[model samples]
Target chain A: MNIIVCVKRIPKTAEADIFIEKDNKDIKKDNLVFALNDWDGYAVREAVLLKEKFEGEVIVLTVGPDESKEVLTRCLAMGADRAIRIEEPIPNDGRLIAETLAKVIQTGPFDLILTGVQAEDDGWGQVGVALAQILGIPHASIVTHIHIEGGKAKVRRELEGGLEELLEIKLPAVLTIQTGINEPKYVSLAAILEAEDKETKEMTLEEIGFSPREPLDATIDQVSFPPTGKRAEILKGTPDEVVGQLTEIIKRKKGS
Target chain B: MSDIFILVEHRQGKIRDITYEIFGLAESLANQQGTSFTAVLLGHDVKSFADDLSRRAPKVLVIEDENLEHFNSVLYQKTLSSLISKYQPSLLLMGHSAFGMDLAPSLSVEKDFPLVTDCIGLTFEEGKLKATRSIYGGKVNASVSLRESKGYIATLRPGIFPPKMHGEIKGRIVMEASPLEGGVDVKKFIEYIEAPITGEDITQAEILVSIGQGIGGPEHIPMFEELAIRLGGTISCSRPVVDRNWLPKERQVGISGKTVKPKIYLAIGISGAFQHVTAMQGSDTIIAINKDPRAPIFSVADYGIVDDFQNVIPILKEKISDMK
Candidate 1:
């Protein structure tokens, strides 16, 4: 069995310096530090689990500028057998990324494909479904658990009302993993050294045999930090008094 | 004449709530632009759904195929991208649901258009599309506008816009043959495993009693559960609670988890972060109980208590238990 995991490089929120570009109002990404998106980490971890259980090869793929290799390297260090970098500096939009991935996956012979439900930065949560569409395969999003046997896969999807729907799909399907699926393992020092020596296959847009059909017209016009909220007023009083005051405040606010 | 396009999302042959919400939003934008709203539907046996959508009064384009009976991004994007190019709508609106998330970016990339995902608010001015989204998780609201004008794409955050009933406005539904040839042939469906049953999902709870890092650990959850039982609500937690494995993933609420709109939300020992706030900001009433008065959760809170949750939670549970 072969499983492919789609990974994305996103700006780490802790180190991200979000500011409006002088000429554009959109959030600027000039100095933001990048890392693998949180959900994608879950996808990679799930693939590793499947690899362990099924004794299969796990391949990690990412589409971004040349710098995206950093994330692919990290995936390899985490135990993926190999990595593929779809080399392009195109905007990290989900659609473009999915399209590039679809083209790449079309050439590979994998039984199952995995991706995170959504990336932390864009939170589009559509890539897996889109890739499913592009590949013309049965796909499920927000999947919490998956079981595969004899070319049939059983998937449980998280739905509203604490309700989960069971879906039965055939082999060679795509599944977008939600967070909490599994804890991602930290890359061991030995694995990191091995990853450094592993070669990555790089593909370009032309190599994928597709071009942007039409130019997307949307752009971030401006970006700014949200205003600081009013500070909470601390009332020093007895517990009874505090409870009374809190109740009064709640009543008043509800009335308003 | 450029028009606005809205994708209608449906599952199990029924339109989702966010579909109407996006329509309501698109209607407003179309009205502001003095342009007509066009809706696109892709699925198997979508004629009935299209008929229902016509009551909303937007021009409808229905693309039906057995392959599309289930949601697939490849076929939807290929079909919708062709329609978008042919119709050339000035703006496209879709719900920020999983379906929209998958289709919008692929459409944007296919057309090489920039896209803004998960927008909470949208407006138009001087022939430009303006959208506002929560940033830094949900701490700050940032407004953005599209630079180019051939078309713009946006996915609206669910629950932000209320669905409106526009009465029956007769519209046309044009069924187009699937433009996708040989249809996606690479993958196949296998099976679905159901998630392990936890308690009720907290996002759907009308009233939620949430615990945070301050609640200590999993051992302390039962005390909050008592409060939840008294209040006729569900017990929920912030991400840290789930991170510590004190609660199941179903009970976690935040940006990465489920977005919730509860009526009465009690925050016990939760320091408000943008990620967590974005999920429950739609609550009718918010009450925060934290030892630190400086916790950000108090900013949007309707009621606040700057006290140790350990002391407050047990007392509140007792009071509610007595009231019952």
Candidate 2:
């Protein structure tokens, strides 16, 4: 069963100070470190594991600028057979990304397409399903477990509140893999260097037959810090001083 | 033809909270825009659901079929596609839950409607749809404008909108059998597996020492457990800790986990993803101790300490002991 895994490059914003650029169109990139999207780690790993078991080719695809090649390389180090980076900046709209990827993916024949449940950046959670719709295939999102047998698959999709629904779908489907689906293997720098056998292919929008059937429907007008209506009072001091204040607050508040 | 429609979501014979929450927005928007607002209820043996929804909208279109008994997005797309074409509602709303995430994008593509998912803020200015979406792991909000079109679609994050119901006469209820003629040849629904809830109920605890991925590894959980005991609290954790099997599902706090509102919620080493924050923000007091000063948790916390958990834990224990 051949597979296509969609990986994304994202800013490490969970622990960083996100600064909206002055233009208000995107986040400031200068102060942030970027890595493969955390959820996409499981996506690439799941693809590689499936390839190992089924003895087929695994392709890691991403839609971003040249900087995204690094994530593709990392996916290759994680044992993906090849990488495809469509040379375009990441778009704010999920539908456009899906369009770009679908056009490229239609060029190949594959039994399955996988993507992270959502991007850590926008958390739109739309690209995979949109891509599936564009390709006219069945799709399931937030998939926690997958078992492929014959030409069909039995998959468990994670619903809210500790519930999972088991569903069976035919092959040539799209699944947005949820986290904890598997333990993503660590990509070693040595493996990154030794990924000589695997290759990263770059493509332009023109090459991918990029033509908007309809104009993009949504545009991110501006970006800003999340409203700080209930912002916390930061304890200013050494660890001892901060701990003194925290414990004091806890002492008064605990069991209140 | 240009109106508003909200997909009424239900599970296990009860209307989900998000459906109500979205009603708060859908009804008001429809009133302001002067377009008819209808609620679309799709399910089998769910007439009561429609009856309940009738009060929320001017009209409730309940499309029932055996295949709709369970939410097969495949069947839903086919059914909703025909309904959308027939009604030609200008705006459609769905909850950004497991259901919407699975359905909205595909509908947008198939319908050629402008799509926005997981919007926390949605409004129409002069009949143009705009939305506020959280980006960068919920650290930033991106304001978006949907292109002009006859049809527009948006998904509201479940917890963002509160449900509104005006006191008035019930609206009309229209019943329609599912239009799709054939069965779902692909994507068959099996059984729903509910993880057995076991262990301590952290939701009841007055103080919760919630650990996140920042705690490093499972080997360190005992240390946090000890800290929890010292603070007279129970040790709960974020989704990642549970994902790593460091803690049981019973101890997880997030959208997919338990919604916790302890007297004093102590979030340790948690960056405060919107999922975790949404659950615990109702706590009487939220104190976040994360080394990352910009962790989103700090924004919701009553007090915050930008320091290493390891260093803060010992001193916190000592200070609490002295105060006691």
* DockQ list for all candidates: 0.24, 0.79
Across residues A8-109, which tens digit of lDDT does each residue of candidate 2 receive? 998887777667778889988889899999889998888888888898999999999889988888888999989999966335368888888999999889
Candidate 2: residue A249 Cα off by (Å): 2.6
State each candidate's clash count: 33, 1
- lDDT of candidates 1 onward, in order: 0.74, 0.86
Tens-digit lDDT track of model 1 for B177-239: 877664564333323233354668766787788898877767888888877877788898887
DockQ of 2: 0.79
Residues A1-256 of candidate 1: C-alpha lDDT, one tens digit per residue: 8999999888755323356667654556777778888888888888988899998899999887888898888888888889998876354445556777888899879999999887776455657766776676767677778888888788777554344556667778888887777766778888888898887888888888868544434444456655655544564577767765655554454355
Please write out the lDDT profile of model 2 over residues B1-324, one tens digit for every residue.
Answer: 377999988877888888888888987788788777888998889877877787777789988788888888999889999999899998889988889999999999999999988999988886789999988877788999988888899999877787775547488998876788867878889899988867788878988999999988888788778778877889999999877778887888988888999998899889888788888889999989888988888889999888888888877777766765
Best by DockQ: 2
